[model samples]
Target: MSLEPKKSILNLEAYKPNFGASNLKKIIRLSANENALGYSPRIDKELKIGGFNRYPPQHSEELIKTISKIKNLDQNKIILGNGSDDLITVIAQTFLKPGDEAIYTEYGFLQFPQSITVAGGIKKIAKDINFHASVDNILKLITDKTRLIFLANANNPTGTFISKSEVYRLINNIPENVLLVYDAAYAEYIRNDKYTDGSELVEKYNNVIMLRTFSKLHGLAGLRLGWGYGNSKLINYLMAVRGPFSVNSMAIEAGIIAMKDIDFQNHCFDFNLKSMKHMEIELEQLDIKFINSSTNFILINLLDKDKFSAKNAVLFFKNNGVLVREMNVYNLPSHIRVSLGTEEENKYFLKLLKKFIRKNDS
Candidate 1:
């Protein structure tokens, strides 16, 4: 018998991530936007001390309580994921079905629509600006068929962000029926008092579901723990759809530790904050155009249009052991994204970048 595949799986393209053996360089890894120092002391201790016994708490009830305490949220309103990526998939599965449509910005996180497609929904792409999600364009594109709208804050590969006022306006304009997914994976990096992470906003705006991750700031990328704060009714539905043990023991242990070790997390966040400022100053001095990042990554476009494509610059950086991502797939073939590293690593990266810029100048 022939094993015939479904048309959707046959046609669907897998989301291509930037990390792999090819990006394993000796100098510094500035591509993935992961913390350089790795997980904190408490996380390390607890993972080892707690032991990955039978499994993580079947429902992540304690984890939800911990997050609620940290964010001052209602435990009932939160749902945990293996990683925030899993949360995205579960949301897609819960809300989307065949013939439904999910919308996202053209150059936002490349993976946002992959979940939608995996859920058997047609993904609609809206226009963008500076690679950030454009709410107006998204509003224009929404229809009765639209089931979900994913808005990635401080979007990947571009690192540009939308202001609070803008996001609020967009939230207000969205119709009550369509689910609005505010992906705030990098929201922990925000230093501005005016900015809202959407966790708190979701309580007020029942249509919104907001994601938060321990991967970026808490140095727990390896642990792969995250949660979504959403309306209680929606969260209850997700609880039914998600895997009972999607979060492993080690990850929950790590998340528990990471949240408690606030001082260490703040140190990492502050370091990235300062590093981002200095980097912007250096890029400006070098006369290179770049986007202002709201997170621990910098997106720069090499202006030597005649000589270097983003891929070529990526090649140049790769040979020099500085791993960065080329934004060709994002429809911006001329830009590259570099992540924040420790002070020493940033110095090394800057040296390599200077060499590349000068060589390309000729």
Candidate 2:
């Protein structure tokens, strides 16, 4: 007889990165929302790479200290992980039990449902309002069995975010028993004065945990480093469940340098703002509709779906050596999310987009 896994594992459709366009050459990869300007130059010059023979630091104290210092977060309330995904899983395992329900918005991070399911928990999806997370919709899903709420401020794929006031409304009303998992992986990219990463809520509420990553703006996706901040009691619980030495030595060293490099961060932030503005202008000129983005990527809506569907657009971009993310997984078949690339890459993307429209219009 064949061995069987849990029923919840069977229900999961495995999460795949590089969803499509795998065979394409990909001259300009705007699929993943990575730092277009790349990591800080200081990482190359200042990073001290060593300690291969020994185990990494048990707690990654140095890296945490750097993060705490820069982010103005408490040191005791912080915990590091392989990536934000790892931290999410740790949170799920720490709090969720079998049959407990975890809430996430319609367009929230794909990893939220996966982590909750893997921990033998039920997944409840709150409907989004015009591609934006609805605070009321999320609150309505909560029940006695609800143990967690996974919310991504400046959510991925759609690139839409609710304001700080809405976030406060959600947090203030939710039962204290339900832990709020605030995923802020794209927080660095947002410049809107109305936005808050929900980090402040961690200080005021024992039930709130805020997650950050070195992957996006830090250009350390390959290194896979992320951290979480919460009340000390909650963080202690996560640390207890997390694997020992989950964070590698190189990731710790690099993350510390990345955190300290404010000049590089500023450069990236400015470039992203400029590129995003340029893309928005080009999209408007071409009469293409897109969600006004507060993150590094924009969700291009194929308004005339019958004439130029997202599926056809993806193929066209792939054929032209540009790879963009398809939104089918997020149940957004008519939309494609394009990450902001270098100046030349963005130009190429806009040019091809214009060409595609003309060809289709003809």
Candidate 3:
């Protein structure tokens, strides 16, 4: 007989990425909430010189030091990874044991369940209130077997977020042994006043960790760079389990340049601010139902489930050479997520969307 894989591995479905057309040059990409302004010019300047022979620095020292300054956290609290997903895997390996449970909200990141399953842990889904993570619902599902919780601050698919006060309440109530993984992948794009990204809680409590990524605002998705901030003990444990030299030397150099390029950072921030407001105003004028997003995207609710479903909207945008995310996989059949692009791209998306609405809806 052939060798059989573990049952946990067998049961897992391969992650389906966006439509293949997403990669084509013809389409205007608004599906992946990427930085529309693109990467900093400084990255190119740094990468022209070579460092291909040696392995990356063991701990990503210089990059972490820069992040420490911006975050006002100790370097000991930081753990760098190939990407935030790598850290998620490390947490699963470090904390989740066979038959133990991990909690995620109903519409949490797809990666959470995959990470849990790969680690041989039982996954529990806590129902959300409307589209936002309901802390109360999450708390109710916490049995003694629960070892971890993953909350997406400035959540994806649905661009809603909970306030810092609410996050504090959740932390105060969670059992001390259970760890909270705050997936703040979109934290940099948030312009709200009340959001925390869970850093304050991570500082005060040993059980909370804040995970951030360079993929979004820093325009370093190609580099696959991300980092986490938590108690020194927890950070040390993750570092112990993580692979050596996961963050390559090239990525390390690019990350340092991107972090220090304050001009580019400000440019991205200003563009997003202008575009998000524009999206809200235009969507309302067209009578489109959309979540007021705190991040770089908006979730348009196509209330006419049968006539103008999310699938239909996807096809419509795809036909027009614009790429937006379909939400059926997220159990949101009537909603589509659109990332804020540059001014011209945003206007084109609005134009095509308005035309689609008039053609189908009217």
lDDT of every model, 2 decimals: 0.83, 0.90, 0.88
Q: Write out the backbone clash pairs for model 1.
A: none
Candidate 2 residue 212 C-alpha distance from true site, Å: 0.3
Evaluate residue 138 in candidate 2 and report its C-alpha lDDT on the 0 to 100 scale. Answer: 96
- Which residue pairs clash within candidate 2? none
Best by TM-score: 2
Query: Which digits, one per residue and each the tens of the lDDT, describe model 2 over residues 187-277?
Result: 9988778998877898899999999999999999999999999999898888899999899999999999999999999899999989989
Off by over 4 Å in 1: 22-27, 48-53
RMSD of 2: 1.3
Clashes of each: 0, 0, 0
Could you tell me the TM-score of candidate 3?
Answer: 0.96
lDDT value, residue 358 of candidate 1: 78
For model 2 the local lDDT of residue 341 reads: 92
